[model samples]
Target: MATQGRSTLDRRRFLGLSAAGAAALGLGMAGSAAAQTPSGASRMPPSIAALGPVLGKAVPIADDEYRARLAKAQRLLAEQGMDAVFIGAGTTLRYFVDLNWWGSERTAGVLLTRSGDPIYITPEFERSRAMEQVRFGSEIRTWQENQSPFDLIARTLRDRGIATGTLGIEEQLPFFMADGIGKAAPQLHLVSATPVTAGCRAVKSEAEIALLQIANDATLACYHAVWQALQPGMTQQDVQALVAQAYGRMGVRGFVDINVGKYTAQPHGSIEPQKIVEGTVVILDDGCQVHGYTSDITRTFVLGKASDKMKRVFSIVQQAQIAAREAARTGGMMGDIDAAARKVIADGGYGPGYKYFTHRLGHGIGMDMHEWYYAVGDSRQPILSNMTLSDEPGIYIPGEFGVRLEECMVTTPAGGRWFTPQSPSIELPFG
Candidate 1:
C-alpha cells in the first residue's frame, strides 16, 4: 500500500523524566546478532523450536508459496549464468525447502539449475519431512546420517549429467560444508551464488509485505502490553519474562531477548539486576515473529515522570528518527538519510563526530532480524520500493544516558510506510 506519513512530534520540551521510572518493557538493539546454532546444537541457546507449539508450527514453506519461490529461484539461476546454484545456508534452505532442521553431522543441500528440475540432498532421518515440504522438486536424495550427505549431492549432479558446468555456492556456506562439497565434487567449478540469491530476495513481494505488516501489528501490540505491565522496582529480568508471556499470548513465535537499562545510555550495555529506580531512563527494544517474518521496535520511556535531561535527549532522537524516515524514498541514496540523522544529532550539539552517534541509522530486517542493505557510513545502496528496513536513530551520550527511537518501515510504490506505530515522545511517562 501507500507508505508515507508525516510524523507529528513535539520537540520543544526539556523536562525531567519519571523520577520513579521502574518497570519492565520490551526493548532491543540494531546491530549484528550472534550466529544462530543449527537446531538442537548445544553451542547456541535453544531456539523457539524447542518450545514446541508454543512457538508455532514447523511449517517453514508450504503449498503455493513453496512452488512460487522455487520457480523464482530457477529464473534467478538463468540470470546469473550459473548451471547449478548450491543452496545450504540456513536462509537459503529456508527459502527453498522450508525446513528449519539443522545439524553439523550431516550436511543438507539442494541443487537448483536453470534447465532441470530441482534436487534435494538431506540426511535419511530428515528425508520424510523434506519429502513432504519439497513438493515441486524432481528428485530427492537422502544420505545415511553416518555417510557423507555431500556425496549424495555430488551423485545427484553426476546422475543428472551436470559435468563441465559452474556450481554456484552460497557465500555464507560453512567452512566444513564447503570442504566436504569440494572433496565430493572436485570436477565442478565452484563460484559464489550470493548475487543471484540476493537479487531474488531483496525486493519483497506483495504477499511478503502483507506478512511483515501482520508481524508489525503484533509487535506493536506486544510493546504496549509490556509497557502496561511495568511497575516501579521491577527487575529487568521480570520485564523480560512479561515480554515473552505477552508476545506468546499474541501468537508470536520467537524468543524474547529483552534489554532494559537505566543511566546506561550506550546501546550494548548489560541490563543489570538493579531495581529500576526513580529518575531513570528506560529503553525497551523488542520484536515479535510470525512464521519467519519479524518486526523490531524500540522505545524509551520514563516509569513515573520525565527528567529534564531525559526529555532533551528523547526529543532530539525523535526528531532524528522522523527526519530519516521522511527522507527514505525510492532511488534515494541510503547514505543521505543516515547523514540527515547524523546531522541532526550533531546540530543539537551532541558533539560534531562519531563520538555521539556510534551506530548506523538503520538496517534491513526480514527472514533473519538484520539481513542486508544496511544504512551505515560506507554503504551507498539506494532505497528501493518494496524493500523493508528499520529507521532507527539514537544519540548515545556515554555514562550520562542514551536515547534512541526506532520503527520498522516498508517501502511502497509511492514511498515508505512505517510498520510499527510511532513510539511516544521523550518526556514524563513516555506518553
Candidate 2:
C-alpha cells in the first residue's frame, strides 16, 4: 500500500478512527515479560512444527537506503564540527550500514569520516565474516588478538589526518573502549554522537512507516483473537502461550505481558503467580517487529465487567492518551504532548504529577524500543514528520490496579495518527 495520502486520511478521520480499516494494528511483545509457569491453556494450539514462518513478508532494507543513511550521518558529522564518528557494532551501526555484528570485549566498530568513505574495524580472525556482512565499507582495518585494537584505531585516525579534531562516538560505546581510545590518542577529544546517530534514526522513512504499520496490525490482530479466546481461569503463562499461537497463525512474531488481578498495578511486570478472577483487572502490554522496525502497544481492561471505579479510571487514562495524541504537532515542542496528557490526568483528579502517572508519557521506537526524543515534561525537541512514538499514559494506584492505554503514532502535517486506533472503551478494550 502507498504510505502517504492527504484526502484519504481526512476521509478516514471523518469516518471515525474506530470505523477505519484494519491495516493499522499489528505486532506485539514477550521474553522479558512477567514470570509464569506454563499452565492448562484455554484453547488448543497448533504444534510448533506446524506453524508457518513469521518473517515471510519482511524485506531487508535496500542497499541504497543504507548508503543514504551514511551520507546523512556524514552531513551531520560535518555540521557538528566532528572529523569522524565511530559507530559501535550495535543498533547505530545497523541503522547506518545494516550489519548485525555483536559488541564484545573486542573492539569492532565502523568509522565514518566526514571527508571519505566509511571504514570497518574488525578482529583479524573475523575479517572474512565481516566482509560477508559489510555493506558500505571497503576498507577493513583488522587487529590481531595479540595487537591492540585501540592503537590500531588511533593510528588509522592519524593516517586519515584526523589526529586532533573531536571524534564523535556513539553513546552506547563501552567505557573501556572509549577509555582505551582516549589513552591511545590523548590528542583526540571524544564527545557523544547522539545528535548524529539519533538525528539519522529519529525520523522514519516512508518504507519504514509501511513496515511499522504491518508490524502493529499483525500484533493487534493477535491481541483481538487471544482476548476472545481467553477463559476465566487461565494463567498468565497460558495467556502468553495463546498470544504466541495467535501470532504464529497471523504470520508475525510477538509477546504478551499479561498481568492478572492485583498484579495489574505493576508496570513492567510481576514475578508473582496470578490468574484470571472475577472482576479483576487484566493488562496486556507488548509489541512486535517487521523487518527490524517495531510497534509498542499496551491495552488494559477488566477480565469481567469492570467495577464502576475501574471504568472511571480507564476513562481517565484513555482521555489522557487522547490528549497526548491530539497535542502532537509537527514543529511543536515535544514536551507539549506529555503536558497535555498530564493535564487530563491532573484535571481528572488523578495527578500531582508522577504521583499517578509514574513514568514518562512515551518513548521513540524503531530498531530499538526506547530510542531518541522521549516524551517527558521538560523535553524541548521539536516533533518532526514521520517520527513515531508511543502515546501511553496511565494511572498506577499501588495497592489497587493500574490503567494504561498506549498506541504507536507518527507525526504528520495533519497531526498524530495511530498505527492502531485507541481502544474503544473499558468494556470493549480491543476495539
Candidate 3:
C-alpha cells in the first residue's frame, strides 16, 4: 500500500555503520541498546533492537549498467523512428545518465541522439553541479537566465543532424517544457517517450533483481522484528515508530503506514488515533529502499488470537496471491494475472469482481514503488521475463477488517518468484 506521508529515519542517525561494519556486528544479533521513543515512554523490544544492517550483499548500479541502459534507449529510439529522445531531470534521466537532478522551473536534462553522445541541457550557473553527476554524457549545453532553454534544445537537436524528424519527449516532462520545445522546433514532431523509456525500465537486469531482493528481505526482517515487539495498548503511531526504529537498527532508511482494527479496511490506512488491543487486527504496509531501489510489502495480523472469520479471509487472500503468482508467466497477458487472483477471491465467496477485492492484483515495482505494466483486468499488456511486479491481493470489508498480502515478485523463465515467502496465516504472518 502507498501512504500519503512518510517519516524517514536515516541509517546514519542510528548505527552509522558501513555494510562491512554491520556484517561484522552480526546479523540477527542485538548490536546496541534500545533507544527511547520520541515520547520517552517506551523502549524498543529486543527483537527490534537486535536488528542489524543487511545491505552487505547489495551492489549499486555500476557505470557499465548506465552505459548499457543508454545503448538500449538509443536502440529503442531508432526502432521507434525518432531522431532523439529528451529525458528530463527525474528517474528517467537518472536511469540513463546516473544524474540525480531535481526538476524545477529551470530546465535540466539530457538529449540522446540516434548516433551521437548525450547532450545535457541546464542553466549556465548549474553547469558545474550537473557536471558532478553526469556519468554517461559529455556535451553540456547551457542557457543563460535571459535565454530560453527550449531554444537551446532545438538547436542542439539540429547540431546533431536531427533537423526534421520525430523527437520523443519523456512522458513525465512538464507540459510547459514540451509546449515550449514544440514552439521552438515547429519542423520536428514531439511524441511520447514511453515506447523508449518504459521499454528499457520495465525489464530488470540481474543486478537490479539482486538489489530488489535484498531490499525485500530487509523489509520482511524488519516486519518480523516489529511483530515480535508488538504489545497491547500500543497506538498506531507507536507501531510506526517501531518500524522506523527497526529500519534504523538495520542501517537503512524506511517507512510504514500502520492501520488498526476497522481502519485496516482502508487500503491506504487512516489518520484517526488507533490503539492495539487483544484480538484487534493490525496491518503494516510499505517498505524500505536499498540503493535507490524500493521494496513494498504488506502484512496483516493480530497481536493476540485471530477470530475465525479473520482466518478464513486471510486464507482466501493468501490463495489469491498464489493464484496471481501462478498466472504471471512470461508471454501471458498481464490481465490474466489479475483475472486469476480475482477469480480466487470471487470463488472464495468475495465475488462479482471488485466487490471485496478493492484494487488491482498488483503493480510494476522497481526503482519507483509504482511503475509500468500494471496487473489489472482491463490491461492487455504481455507479461515478459525479468519483469518485476507486486503480487498484492486484498479483501476489504468496511466497518470490520481487511486482509492484504503483498510481496514483490520477479517473472522468470519458469514463472513468477516472490522475493520473500507469502504470509502463511494471520497469526504467523512472516511464515
Best by lDDT: 3
What digit string (tens of lDDT, one per residue) describes model 2 on residues 81-134? 888988787878888888889888999988888867888999999999999987
- How are the candidates ranked when ordered by TM-score, highest leading? 3, 2, 1
TM match of model 3 to true structure: 0.92
- Lowest lDDT block of 10, candidate 3: 4-13
Residue 397's C-alpha lDDT in candidate 3?
A: 95
> What C-alpha lDDT, on a 0 to 100 scale, does residue 91 get in candidate 3?
76
Off by over 4 Å in 3: 3-34, 37-43
lDDT of 1 by residue, 1-431 (tens): 00121111111011111111112122221111321222212221222212222233223435677677777777877777777887874766776667565646467777787766678777788778777766565477888857887777777788878765778897667778877877899988888887677666666777677767777776566556556656677665555544554544555543333334444466644534455655577776646567777677777777767778778888888788777777777888778678888888899888575778778888777775666667667567877887888888887776777777778887654556888667766543334
Worst 10 residues of 2 by lDDT: 1-10
lDDT of 2 at 199: 90
Candidate no. 1 TM-score: 0.80
- Best candidate (score: TM-score): 3
Q: Write the per-residue lDDT of candidate 3 for residues 212-306, one digit (tens) a residue.
A: 99999999998999898788887755666666678878877676777789988988766677888889888887777898888989999997799
Please identify which of the two predictions, 2 or 3, would achieve the higher lDDT against the true structure: 3
